[model samples]
Target: MTETLPETAERLTVNTAPNWRYMLQEYDELYRYLPAGGSDKIAGHQRRVREAIARLLKRNADVRLQPRAVKPVTAHLRRALDEGRTASLAPAVRALDAVAEDLSWQYGYEKVPKGLSQNYAYAELAGTRGPVVAEDIILGVVLFAPGCTYPAHAHKGITESYVILSGAVSENHAGVYVPGSMIYNPPEHLHRITVGKSEPALLAYAWMGERENLHEQKMVFTRTRK
Candidate 1:
């Protein structure tokens, strides 16, 4: 039987770290976009998702790591384990779990010089449901440190979307997005994201195609030595 939304939310909450509440809420919202016939049945699902988020928020204060510097010229791609392989998404999930663990220990944010930043990704569908279409949506989290700028970039076949899980993010096309906000980048739309002060920012995103071809463009800017 198809699992009920509440049950699914509960399972997700129980399995993830405390910081994942905001991310869970994003998934809950995605559920809302499902067909309307099951709305009532899913009400409990929404509640479970909210409760999970609340639990996570309450535990946020317990996080103790500090943000690290991200250099402009360095590219921080935590290579995907499923790259060039037709394996199941399980490896991708493990990769994300590993990244999350590392991020938690090292703090959520990483500063990438003026022109670049760090990224940690996990592909959920690959492990659980196998590949679909030309690609499958990979779910992962990205942390950004203050003063870091992610140069403009675009994905050719893949459209991407992010849900702000913590802190704040300033996007060139979408403006500033605070926690709980969502942003969408249609296929091939050039854009950039810059982190702000106060704390490291975390966002949950989905890469919609072959991970390799996802990034089609990067921002252009003149550089000067400090």
Candidate 2:
């Protein structure tokens, strides 16, 4: 039987909208296979992120197409993806690459700091203000130009984790992280990131917090006290 026009349109929408949801599935796979390194804290975090994504998938959240935008730092995104494709985290990177053109990169600051204006940006994939429209968890990617220093910052009431997908970064001068490594930061834990000088770094991050806190989350750099 010939389908009605509305039925056909709905089927088309369903088929075409799987791109973003596929990206989320890739994220779940990435988290599921990541090594916990025997740290119970990390193990728990990984499990929670995977479970939240599972629940989100069951809900079949609608995908909202963002107004495509780019920044100076995005010039390195291709290189980042290329490098990421050769790493252990290739699948996750490929998923992001699929939707790269639709991503809306922003500095997430009201008044942009000087040096950072051109070197760093983030695109949210799922959250209160992102395409997926969720309040319990936020998933996104952050890109950094070579030799960029992301000033010290902390998220209040939020436990955040970053999975390095490409290039390398150092957190608080503590250690260098390569592709497929996960860095975890508890709520209100002040941290700084510095990308290596040779290539851009791309990181996938997840934020888990109370509904109100997740909805009202703000990004602010810490003041340097002399």
Candidate 3:
């Protein structure tokens, strides 16, 4: 039998810290300040992200510490955080640092491409598999080493968005997205990311979709015919 959200919440209350709770609040702030760029679609995505976060906050989801883990790319985390502290995403970065030791960074792929493992990794802040147990939304951050090129990929049935917190990156070579920029990708929208050469990049992302999809989504890169 599956555990209901209320039951999960009740069982998780004891281990959650005040800092974890504050992190969610900071995330709410992060999404709240995102500029819509005069696009209703963008505004709608922002609204959904904030509203989902609001719902999670209202439920007071438990935030228990996961086992600490790291990746080669995380070595750049310190620099990213340092840069973010003075950037517009300062609040979110600070809150993330409070629970940094407990974050479990992963590649999210069954088979990571060569060199990619050392260049990138992501950690979930709130989701079905994260410190916060939620089914409707996923909140996380991805870190990339300088000059990293993340291969083309897309989330099936998931509408996603990323807000650059530190350094700079270009998605599909469209433009350089500096700190405080927002990028939106609808479901199954193929896209690729490349980080700037001089500094590591950190981006906060959110995914919203059906409960089943949100819980069971798989990660796979798009391959091109040679």
Cα lDDT tens digits, model 1, 1-226, are: 9776654433232234333333344454543443323445334433433343345344442222223333321132222222201222233233344434323222212443433333322223211122111122344456555556666666677656765655567888468886545576667767777776545555556555454654332323333336
Best by TM-score: 2
Query: By descending lDDT, how would the candidates be arranged?
Result: 2, 3, 1
Better of 1 and 3 by TM-score: 3
Q: CA lDDT of 161 in candidate 1?
A: 70
TM-score of each: 0.44, 0.93, 0.91
Q: In candidate 2, what are the lDDT values of residues 144-175, reduced to their tens digit?
A: 99999999999999999999999999999999
C-alpha positional error of residue 86 in candidate 3 after TM-score superposition, expressed in Å: 1.7
lDDT of 3 at 123: 94
Deviation (Å) of 72 in candidate 1: 13
Tell me the lDDT of candidate 1.
0.43
- Model 2, total clashes: 0
On lDDT, the leading prediction is 2
Candidates, ranked, TM-score: 2, 3, 1
Better of 2 and 3 by TM-score: 2
Q: Give me the overall lDDT of model 2.
A: 0.89
